[model samples]
Target: MKRYQAVRGGTGDLTKPDVNTRVQDNLYLAVNSKWQKDAVIPADRTEIGVNTAIDMRIEKRMMSDLDKMVSDNKVPAIKNLDKAVTLYKIAKDFAKRNKDGAAPIQADLKKLDALKDFAALNQDANELDEVYGLPFGFEVEADMKNTKVHVLEFAGPGTFLPDTTSYKQEDASKLLAILQKQTVKLLTMAGMSEEKAEKYVAAGLKFDQKLAKVVKSTEEWSDYPATYNPYSLSDFLAKIKSFAMRDFLKELLPALPDKVIVMEPRFLDHFEKLINPDNFDEIKGWMVIKFINGLSSSLSQEFREAGFPFSQALSGQGELIPQERHAYYVANGVFDEVLGIYYGKKYFGEEAKADVTDMIKKMINVYEDRIQNNDWLSENTKKKAIVKLRALVLKIGYPEKEKKIYDLLQVDPAKSLYENEKALSKITTKYAIDKLTKPVDRSVWLMPGNMNNACYDPQRNDITFPAGILQAPFYDLHQSRGQNYGGIGATIAHEISHAFDNNGAKFDEFGNMKNWWTDADFKEFNKRTQAAIDIYDGLSYGPSKLNGKQVVAENIADLGGLTCAIQANKVDKGSMKELFENYARSWAQKQRPEAIKTEIAVDVHAPQPTRVNIPSQCQDEFYETFDVKPSDGMWLDPEKRVRIW
Candidate 1:
């Protein structure tokens, strides 16, 4: 306690804390008030936290390494690191890029202009994405029913706004105006007159509005069952009358399968309606906007500046990120594994990997025990749960089968950044297409080690802990087990619990979308899930409230994760105070009020303050540890508190 106090800037007013401020009552504020008081969210950022801080640190290191790779002639010495350096060097040439203006994408724009009909558009879709990238996406993901094979999937076009619900906002007119102004500016820079640009913006706005009606909102899509509709090619064609589904797939698919997954059937239905000859002008306008927005960072200073205000309005960022930093991020996106391998080799040591791996094993053990002891589930259900838990794949630190996607990458420093990115996109597309014929590789990892986030892929039944997230605030080799358990332990548990969350629970041990639970057991599960939803639905941050129905799966995972971690701590012989305090400290964050509003509306995860306080308040152990009573601001009624694992 003394050590924690000393490290956290000594004790301050524990006895005479502000009651009205609600700081005394909240565990998060009590643990992190000293740091929170001084924390500042960067002007270019929406929010700032331990995660972001660590990412910035890693970015600086990557930038330095890139500089060395380019200037110090270290590229040839390393095996795969040169590809990242090559991409970085090409993008880093700001002067040449600014001078080139929109010339690099001019040929691509000409191709779009020459598209005479829908047939031409279909034929060019794959090629066009390689140049400007597509808002409409296609993928071959693991089949939900038959998990052994990859299935062709079609999804709706990506929105310019943060989410589909943004189109229906009461203040939507204001957002539309911002989009109009930005679109006009971008088109004008792309050689269109201001008058003509306004016309395009009008068409684009109407097109998106029509599409928004049928497109699923982020909240709606979170329901796995809602997006799981499947159809045969003939059946899919019959559902829509406006377009030839078979003809469209001729160019898009190498060999059209009899069966295809319709992720958003409503969107596809409306998209067919929206794709007539009369709508080409509107489609062209939307395509132009997407093209310009996608490559804005790699364009001239004017083009980049033109897109900033709209981005700022969307995300509530005060200023655009620095050009060098922006280029670094672009390199990371294009050459993910190249940078990941370098990052892991440089920053993540063997000791850290070993420690994290051991921690993961412990958490998995705890979850198996949890499932075995759970009273609500039937014996058969529990046995199936244990089977799935045991089969859970763990990928800690980095991938064992090295990702060598950069072998074909060739970037010339003298070429424009847009040209280099376009070239890389073609190679990436080819790589994705190559996977269509291959068997499902269970060892494949979805996330890069350089990313400061963890993920659980229900289809793969796997959890990934990237090297970037394996450090500080989350884990420390020298720190006490209590602190480590509270930091990374909760994160590990959260992801594991995701396997049992609303969406993930649909998939069984073999990663097939088969229910392992009995009808009665599933009914009980729904009741508990509904209770959780009701609790989160009522939570408010100032005037803004949470859409608990949208974020229930994540919230359930959060509670389950924290509970599992706390239980694991009990087994590991750790202090509750240390574990609980560190848990609060891990979620310590601050954001702009505007950012808070955006997050509450669009983000699947709860706001930082909500994340820290809500989980602790719901736990009985939290109350016991802190001696919290009904009179305290953070206290909840015993029956109101919801729990599920």
Candidate 2:
């Protein structure tokens, strides 16, 4: 349900397909075939599509504005934008960067190497968090059951590959080899001998193999709301072996918490063997590579070249994006909200926000009708669903004010880029720690206004529609109402539908995880959910097959959103043909094979072709719009269609 804000790999063929393709056979190809044939994917980009096109246009405009602001000494009066400009200057200053090649991270590398045993590592826990994301997973977030307060979240560190399942692939050895080669190159540049670097990377990988066996996979993580398994603070500490988690928690948090959430109980059940005296060397090696790998991008150009292989392997890009573009991305990542506000203030209109807000409400009204008429849900369940829909807080364009931490984050001109990044991380770490006792602040937006994306945060019970996504294909005042309905209208419904999606269904209207469905109604809902899964399971994607269960949440949302969009359009007698064509047109894309393989393996959403074609066929209006016959290749059985809102 998210549109990426980057030039990601996509769904169309790399080679040209027949432009004379019939709409009944493949609607996506028929509507967007010619455009796909002519469009050239940039050398640095793995794929090209409508979302990437919109993202490129927005990023270009923002980069140009940033340059002008810096050159003319005319930064806007927006809060903390001056800090962004300062960081932007730091990122763009390659002369200083080239001069200070690798020196900035050398000290940090020494610090990591200094940890020889459990005592030293345990003693340096706070610094470990401030510098590197710790070897074991640690996060402070608002508890799912109690959204008003924060809790300490613990889990095993993530595996090197996309998921633990990837480690089981036959080509796993080859992929691990590529990562090893790059890590060795990076460590050697960090003043280690080639032999030592290779040994360290190999040892690190061995540890990774062990860790992967204990951690959760992407599919398991998809059911995220069920991650809340709280234990009393003392009982939680008793589970760990040889790690002074109690003392570590005390050093970082405001006070000793009453409870902590353990995300993966199985991971902790094996925590003793993972981090002990006998395995110190292997653990240290893993730590060395992880720290250097995390901060290598902001290091010297040598480090960037050394580190490019793993990234290039994931995305089949010929070369990196230009340095200026990289600089903007890095700086913007740090000051996202500050620059988002600037973009929205200059480019977004108040009238458009009001109009889109009205559009969202109307779409919700249609969804409400569907819920009321739903056969599976009883009246009790429908009432709760309606309350949740009505309570969905809308973050239309951007927030009126920024988070307080931005005012406190200052860029030190004398420090290196890596050092400045570390400094910012420290400030943010302190900020999050300070919020442990404070009430959760839902006013802080999840995505920046300059991002070409939208999301539904189940924990906060809200949906965000950024100004950047309000462009040609998704939304615009000039587009006809029918076109908009096909584009952003379906998209709006898509995000709203997430409130009732697989994971979100566990949470109540106030964003607490509680069962609100009757036993039989929930059983019926699961049956429909399986129907959505059956629609996509075992389907062939390029060089891969789709996993129905892995993608069922998004597929369910897609069907529900498209269904709601179709019903809403019929109310106004909108052109069904126009809606269907634009819906396919919006998902038009061309993807590289390497990118497609990775996407199918890890990405939650189906390929763009699947998104457009599969969901469209399920809707009855689609058959009427294009005169789809039973003999057509794309014609699907009515019994296979699923609409679970």
Model 2 sits at a Cα RMSD from the real structure of 4.2
TM-score list, all predictions: 0.93, 0.96
Best by TM-score: 2
Candidate 2 stretches with Cα past 4 Å from truth are 1-16
Candidate 1, residues 419-488, lDDT tens digits: the string is 8878777777766655665677788888877888898988889999999888778888988888988889
lDDT of 2 by residue, 554-641 (tens): 8877887888888888886778887878888888788777777778777788887678877887888888878877767567777766
Model 2 lDDT, full chain set = 0.83
lDDT for 262 in candidate 1 is 88
Clashing pairs in 2: none
